[model samples]
Target: MDFALSQEQQMMQRLMRDICSDYGLEYWREKDEAKEFPHEIWDDLTEAGFTGLTIPEKYGGEGLGMEEIVAVGLALGRHGGGVSGPNMLTLGPVFGGISLTEHGNEDQKERWLPEIVDGAIVSLGLTEPDAGLDTAGIKTTAEKDGDEYVLNGTKIWTTGAHVSDYIVTLARTSPMEEGSRHQGISLFVVPSDADGITTNKIDKLSMRCLGSCEVVFDDVRVSEANLLGDEDSGFYHVLGTLNTERIIWSAIPLSAGELALDLAVDYAKEREAFERPIGKNQGVQFPLAESKMELETAKLMIYKAASLYDSGEDCSMEANAAKFIAARAGSNACDRAIQVHGGMGFADEYHVERLYRDVRLARVAPVSDELVKSFVSTNVLDLPRSY
Candidate 1:
């Protein structure tokens, strides 16, 4: 099996590196300190055509595959952390393109995907106040009218909701099936200003500059044309879309792990302790060595997952395993980086502190650590599924 980047893939990585080179940890740290999103950098990425790298070319996108997509995200994350790359780019593809690419009529694609590629923001509405990882439990419902659906319910932990102009929201369209819990669930596109929508900011533990909103939909109206896929099949389709999401998440953390390792190694060479460079000490040298090993392992797993996804293979187990391993390695890498930097690491002025906080966010959402374990145990080992 060939395991090499094509000329085009290398070129995309070079382009992303050039763009991300200008937005270092200091720029991200300053944005985090202000609790504000980086629209200036956002504009730059938009201008670069990197924002909609996954959206179809017919809709004014580059139509790049997962290999190129991961390459772009990883290069950015290797410098700017998650938000500056995957966290910022993946939402548009996952939510904006989930329906548009798979089910959108020509008009829908014409109406939305081009703008999304051109930097019009889009986001998803799946995780609700009550629905964490149990997407089937989503209480949000869109009742059908003659040509429009009146939507009402609440969604929580919605990232980029405030800035996005459109949302692919999952809602209950039919009453629950007698035996199946996932049935009767549907997805729809809702305009951000659809009359009855309201958002309140949810204070976050980290990625503070990345906005998550608790949104309430009060009788919002949407046309029937906005339905994402066949009514009552959205749950399956949404889950399908997330396989890519997991890869993107997995790939992103690997990049962050690289950044963490880079920070630790560079710091060790320059910082002095006991009249010698910290690089000479085993305490310093060992952790960095182990971190290098772990980061490389995690990266291989991420690529394995991404390649399987690109080949249209069954990648659930690989994706879950990659995300689990990569996130832990990313956490370990940042922690080790911070430890290597000593007091300077804790001080945001030195930058490792920001990586520490951002790296922690890799664990909590998308799929929680416990849930990923459950997925592997049940799906891969052929054990019983856990509730």
Candidate 2:
């Protein structure tokens, strides 16, 4: 298959890189240090027409596909935004916009899609304190009361929820049936500012600018109109979006790894040791070379997954593999970059430490590496399913 980016895709990548370059590494470091949202950069992205990359043209979006989305995400990561920049896009335009575009009814689309394009941040609330990755095990309940649904549950790791305008939440609306754990789940677009909804920001080690949060819905009420897609079918709807998210998340590591490798290489070439540049030594050169190779290999998988998704093909295996490989490669690259820089790498000024913290999250959230391997074992290799 042809893996080369088309002219349009190349242009999109260049545009994203240019925009992201305007906000240098120092800006990212400051935001991370203060645990503040990159509101200025976010506004620039919205104004540059990136927040609407996946939404339909009828809703004031560019009507692009997953490939362009991945391109923009990678550019952000490579240009020093790391996971923070991509996370904002994913939480809002990519995840929220894609969910609404695919599942929302015409009225729902008209109501929410434009707002996202206009830079209304929307957070996803799926992982509860108990459920974790077992989405089927969530205890969040949305009980129907007359014409409204009252939601009660606590969602942990609700990224961007504190500042978001709305949250696309998944909750159990009915009793679980025998042997059907995935059923009874439903999705909703609950207003973040609604009464009874409270958000407490989580102090995180990485991706601090995104404001990962614990969002509590204590009898939070929403009209029937807020329901997204069919009740009891939310799990399937969420699965439909998972492949896209995996591909986007994979870009996090791909870009971060590339950036880290670049930094290490530049440092190696200039930093002198023993009366010569350290890069001349095989010890410094070997790890950077290995990281470059691994990062490039992972990048191909990311592009392949994105292509499959854009072409309307099933890509669960490819997407999962890409996420796993990319996360590992990116984290490893950052670790090695720190090693190459020695003591300076540990310092915040060099920025490798921040990238290291941010890249490490990819292996856990979005989906764990072990879970991805389990999926491959059961689904791809035709092995027995291991619970």
lDDT of 1 by residue, 1-387 (tens): 677778988898888888878887788888888878778777888898887787888788888766777777888888675534567876676567645787677888888888888787887888987778999888898898899999999999888888789888999988876678899898888889889999888887677777889989999999998887789988987876777788788876777778878988998999987999999999899999998899888878888887887777888988888888988888888899989988888998777787778778778768889999988788788898888
Reference-based lDDT, each prediction: 0.82, 0.90
| TM-score, one value per model | 0.97, 0.98
User: Candidate 2 regions off by >4 Å?
Assistant: none
Clashes of each: 0, 0
In model 1, how many backbone clashes occur? 0
Residue 161, candidate 1: C-alpha displacement in angstroms: 0.3
What TM-score does structure 1 among the candidates reach?
A: 0.97
- Give the per-residue lDDT of model 2 (tens digit) for 1-387: 677888988888888888887899999999998999999988989998899999999999999888888888888888878778777778777678999999999999999999999999988898988889989999999999999999999999988998899999999999999999999999999999999999999998899988999999999999999999999889998886888889999998778888888889999999998999999999999999999999989989998998888788999999999999999999999999999999999999899999999989999989999899999999999999986
RMSD of 2: 1.0
Off by over 4 Å in 1: 82-84
